[model samples]
Target chain A: MAIPLIQFINVSKNFGESHVLKGLNLSIYKGEITAVIGKSGTGKSVLLKHIIGLVQQDSGQILIEGQPLSQLSPKKIKLFYQKLSYMFQDNALFDFMNIYDNIALPLVENSRFPKDQVNKKVLKRMDQLGLIDIEKKFPSQLSGGMRKRVALARALVMDPEIVLFDEPTTGLDPIRKKKVHSMIQEYQKKFEFTAVIVSHDIPEIFNVVQRIALLDDGIIKFEGTKKDILDSQSKILNDFIAGKDI
Target chain B: MLNKLIEKFGEKTINLLKSFGRIILFCFSGVTNIFTLPFQFAKIIEHMWFIGTKSIFVIILTGLFTGMVLGLQGYYSLVKVGSEAALGAAVSLTLISELGPVFTAIMVTARAGSSMAAEIGVMRISEQIDALKTMHINPVRFLFSPRIIAAAISFPLLTALFDVVGIFGGFISGSMMLGINKHVYMDTVIQSVKIHDINVGFYKAFAFALVTTTICCYRGYYTHLYSGFGARGVSLSTTNAVVHSCIAIFIFDYIITFFWV
Candidate 1:
């Protein structure tokens, strides 16, 4: 009954001859973790990009907090970006900047926060992620898990209302993946912000997300509770569940 | 085969026009971006380190050797004309007016421009540019403007350095090697080269700097618009930046000459 925080209304996108997204309609509520599961190259990342205005839809509308994103000018779109944050799959921290500066960059660039305040916020986030000791380390110096954690900390530095994760659990060992999954759960619980995760790692994401959306052939085939996804009888869903088709 | 060839050529021509149009847009946006953030002195200083200080050694080496070669060649030509004392004027004029800025930009294109394309292209593919946008940071103001401002400021100074060193090279060749009277050689240069020539050279250098930096940054910034091998995309952009910079420098040089003459 509540107004959804983000909504995609008949959204579609095409890259040349290939249609990546086709009339995809979905809505995400505030303070909920919604996991989008799909095979590789199923336009999961492309869908996430549209939420943040990185990629534009060819048709339909993307609404953030009920305001149409497609109708906004570039300047207004940029203003809307302050409320949303995206953590890239590869944890694309600027290699040239140290971890502290990487996390402090948004604050220094956008907000009126003084240097000392920025440093203090960065240090606090570093401490929260148990990365206080690695403040001076560059992205090249950190391990894969450490880099993702640092990136997540940076994403949360501005305390955005929504966070989108692109394959957050990829390239991690089982234990590290579990840790990352729990970290997502922990952040969601603490902040009560909207979280949309795009991943193929179903089991890990299933534990955190309340609803699962399965995408195939440029369409959302199913959208329901995690139990509905587990007990799905749809051939496409079964094929995805058995890992028989991508 | 004929149809395929025509199609390919047509595509290339369209692409060329598109590139030209994009560059005009980039220049307009760059001007607006500078006005929007007129107090970005710290960023300008930071990019001075990247675009100026980082390329200093290459610029100096290219300038010195170019001067040395010009001195050697000009001396031989002047001797044939029985005007060996005019070596200084010839070397200084050529180096300052053409070789100094153009060669410096080309060398930088090979070094810094290629690296910049690679760095920014990788960032584009990786979605780092998107991250900047999500944080409400304008990539043009944060990334591109500093490099443009830095190169514009440094190119003229480097051209001056090149001119002085080149004339010194000519001085050594004429007086020491060819045994021309040192006083006469110096007097010939001082009399033949007017201050207007120096002013024109600096103006041309400034224009060259703007062209080179704008092209390189534009290529790197929009590299993702092209497909296929990412490395190949970067390689093509680097080549385009260098070729376009050279052609633009010469074309602008002719226009300036037309007016100055």
Candidate 2:
């Protein structure tokens, strides 16, 4: 098999008495859009976090581009982190910064991109993301959808090899949701970057995501194409697919 | 019962040591990157403006009132011994040696330090810090070092301002109000106020700045890890940051004074 772009090797995580991930093993191939679907409070976000080393596994390891995340030293970890970008559920844009500066932060801070270049890059990203007339506006000034787009612009400005989206369509209206999903699909098609999205918007994302991983009881119960999940014999998986909490 | 008590004591002791070790490690990390490459000159300027320049009004007001009170109180006490001439010496010494640095630090801990904690705590909860990490930026170096360095630079200057304003206030209260020989009071203050006294105050101010900023930043940075998340967590961190900064400032002030004096 082709080497996995992202790998969770029997990972386990516990938040006090709550075990979020238990010996969970999953892999994402390069240039593929993988959707991680599970009930709320499952470790889907936690798994995304582990990919970026924002959180650690209590047992086992996560690997990005074949390098184990846990084994990397702090210096190496930072270097490794530049390869992946996480688009948070809340957008997590700095409210203090305008759209331009917010998008340019990673570039400016990490790459120390020059002022003129930073301006050009930020403007280009904003234009591509259809964020016009909002460059100077702060995150608080924008609508939720606009803020999400600005955050996507920020994440895309860095242009990492992998982008993890946490609930990409959680709070958007249908039009905005389709807009976001289409943007993700178009971006993934163009950039060919590995995309792992943790989302609750069911069959809606079915058309956008190529593969689906069903997380149940802290373990991935099913990993297959959307068609395979649709045809699965597992009643719990079916229950979840039918939008029922098991 | 005895075994359980021992177990509880051991657990608490271990937790304390763990927290102490983490603080030390965080401080070391901060110190390592403080003067390193990619120094945040703009951020430091912004923080200095926030922590120092903007705080002038309050510092001036506090200094004026504190000095006036000291002068008024010192005159009555010194007059009982018929040593009213020593009132200037008392006010200047009290300010230059202790009150200037301590009170200025306490004020900063309340204003800038608490706000810094709250800001970072909110960032932690909102995952802005995590966003920074994903971008390969050291959140501590980016979010914290500037504030710490600014506090270190601003504290001494503010203390100096406090000292000067306070002396003027004392002048207003003493020579202007108490009917003392104005020239004598001025002369005593000018002659008796040695550089050692001012030096000690500046040194203590620097120490207090480090204590306040470090503790406050630590509280904010680890609030999510130690406490929890959301508004309640941020509020707790802000409160704890101010209280802890005050406690640390007082303890360090005593320790530094004992050793230096």
Candidate 3:
């Protein structure tokens, strides 16, 4: 059996009177695409946030490679964070910075690479993503799909081991949504990076995601491969996959 | 009814105090980040150009007119007392001790401070700040520290420019327009203005810089917490930044004057 790369053990979170995550336990394996599907406001995004250390869990522990995150020393924690990347729902590209600068920001802020080297790395990544002749254009100048690509380029520029995507295809047409899913699948294969996506695309998402975790009422109600989910006896889980509200 | 009234008032008071405490902590974070390694020198320079260099024309225009008005008014009042020859002393003293720093700060608050709030509020609402955090960068250090440092450097320079241009403006009204001796006007300004007055102006400029930039940036950085979400949030933050900074400048100016005097 493969050891999980990241694990959430009986974690919980509450925002005032509303409890978001309750005694949730999950594990993310290395180099696979896992999609967290849930109804709106069911703490799907919160789960992703906890994985990236944006929002800390109120209780329980998150372990990375069998070592608890809270127990890691400051130096180890810094190294741990360097191995993760996030793609926000809105892309969150710096509107003030052009394409070149936006993609190069992580390298510039985190590394001692020289100007030419940064340029070479950024240019190569942009070229591979087919982002040509738009280095000077700001994020606002790009179309929604193009902006998504730019954001993915920025996320991959650091060569992180895990990438968390929060609703990568919200507010897109069906074709664009399919394109985004394919893009994620293609990149996940090419880079061999672990992916955890929060999505609501229903059956469209099942095609790309190898594993599905159905969250309900502050806990993950189901977790398994697509075949296992289809073969399960839980009616609510089947309804959820059919785009029905539980 | 009486118990409910008291409870309401108490709640409001506690909330206000909590807000004040948070503002203080936010300011401390921004100032402390300046000493942190890999200081944002380039960003600071860019902001200085935006806040200081871009503001030269407006500062000059206001300063010149203010000096001219002081000369004219001082002439009328001093003429009544038969001491109109002291016009140079009067004009330079008013500008150097008080008007230059206060007016320059107000102008900058209106122009740069408001924009700072709006821009940061947008970034907060849009979660660009969070993106910075995910990249292992401190958002406050990246976004707020540069503006703070730039404002600190720019305010005193702008105040000095205001004083110099103001004195020259007084020359136009007192010596050139009103036909007072040019040498006498220039001589009185040079002779009567003490180093103490200049020092007070610079100190006030520095203090105002801290008060205005801190308030503006704090309001913007915590826009989500303060003003709900979206365009309304950004709008409210900008309004609060401008209003609070103006009020703070006046209050701080009075405090500084009380101590100096």
**Model 1 Cα lDDT, one tens digit per residue, B95-176:** 7666776676667667776666667776776668878987878887777777777878877877777677667767776677
Per-residue alpha-carbon lDDT of model 1 for A1-246, expressed as tens digits?
777788888899999999999999888888999989888888989999998878889998988778887677888776667779998988889988999889999998876888889988889988877797887889999988889888888888988878999988777788878877887889789988789999888666789898788887788888877789778788887777678865
Runs with alpha carbons beyond 4 Å of true place in candidate 2: A64-79
| Most accurate candidate by lDDT | 3
Q: How many residue pairs clash in each candidate?
A: 0, 0, 0
Q: Kindly list the per-residue Cα lDDT of model 3 for residues A174-243, writing each as its tens digit.
A: 9878877897898889989999999989888999988999999999899989998878998889888776
The candidate, 1 or 3, that scores higher on lDDT is 3
Quote the B-chain TM-score, candidate 2: 0.97
- Candidate achieving the largest DockQ: 2
Q: What TM value does model 2 have? A: 0.96
| Model 3, position A102: C-alpha lDDT score | 95
What lDDT would each prediction earn against the true structure? 0.80, 0.89, 0.91
- Candidate 3 local lDDT, B65-147, one digit each (tens): 99999888888898899888889999999999899999999999999999999999999999898899998888988898889
Alpha carbon lDDT at A132, candidate 2:
90
What does DockQ give for each predicted structure? 0.78, 0.87, 0.76
| Superposition error at A204 for model 3 (Å) | 3.1
